[model samples]
Target: MSIRTNVINLTEFRNARTGPPKRSEPESGLMLGKGLTDQTMIDLIKKFSNPVSERDYRNRALLNLMYLTALRAKEIVSLKFSDLFLAPSGETLISYTKKGGKLAFAVIAEETLFFIREYHSTFEGDHAYFFLSLPRGNQKERSNLSTRGLQLIVNSWNVKTCSNKLIHPHSLRHTAASKLMDLAGSIAVQKLLNHSSPNTSSLFYTKPYFNASKFISWE
Candidate 1:
């Protein structure tokens, strides 16, 4: 016999405006590494939306999908087409390649899919990996992008945090985590970012549970 469990929609997308700081009552995001303001993140997305070269398409995809989904640089770089799917709900689902290959998933907005498509169109070969290294001089290409290469693209954008630290891949991740935490609370952040303890249930216990990804909605 099959049992049916209720799927809860926990998503709470805040408008892209700064809220008053809760100095007296700290939020879970406060404990996280410093991240960009929501407005700044939106601005960054707009900044990279235009592409002249294939590399530009890759960068635009990185900015939109990575920021929207809160993926770690390593996971984003390690992504292959096999790890992605479009759910019946029409949301983009990604199975992250995290440390030890631990399972995780997050939903991305449909518009971000356009950026992904534009980026993938530039692939020199029909490689399995979604992000790849650019071809140099005469060498044949289509290698998966490394974490360091992801860093270079992020750096080329010259994004920085409040402390002026270059927004390395991790900083961008922090920004994504903060975005989730700010509007959805720590539980939603945990659900989206897979911040479970060894004692807790994996947020994505079953692939079917991907239906719960609505909680992390960017809208």
Candidate 2:
């Protein structure tokens, strides 16, 4: 279950507080929480893979692309062939609708491009959707994966990989935002994530600043 779900019982907590929740001071000498490294992400991709056939491979590719692009699962499910473009510098561009139906573009890795090509060639469905669903009994159509289906895929992979970290499809979006903040600082992350306000961006970018007084000498 998500930590957000366990925060408070909405029915019991009716009163709104004027002040924000209190935060604890960080330990003077503890290592900070680390974001998932690129190597760690690569391992996660491999861990989610199945040896049985190419179907799992396609799913993994979709997951990777979603993470790499920092796209919401709905945006991913809504993607089409025309939404992808190859830049002159060999980068793959993933274009999709943002909040408010605004157009946004994210640069994808070369491997994601290759996998997308493979999926397109291997897919047997006539649907215009990028990620085609496996036919269900009496469904008689290839449909786009639902948001719930995307969550199930993430949950299943998390279980199979023995990763207890509460990683949802949205976690990838958070992961990308966190990494961007770590790499380029808050301003850049704010722009990339398309946050309307710096305050909103700060929620993801700001961390507990560690302080130690032992090193200082008073004159």
TM-scores for all predictions: 0.70, 0.66
What TM-score, to 2 decimals, does candidate 2 have?
A: 0.66
lDDT score for residue 107 of model 1 = 83
Per-candidate Cα RMSD to the true structure, in Å, reads 17.5, 11.0
Global local distance difference test of model 1: 0.69
Per-candidate clashes come to 0, 0
By TM-score, how accurate is candidate 1?
0.70
**lDDT, candidate 1, at 80:** 72
Clashes in model 1: which pairs? Answer: none
lDDT at 10, model 2: 49
lDDT of 2: 0.66
Can you give the lDDT of residue 38 in candidate 2? 59
Off by over 4 Å in 1: 1-33, 197-219
Best by TM-score: 1
Best by lDDT: 1
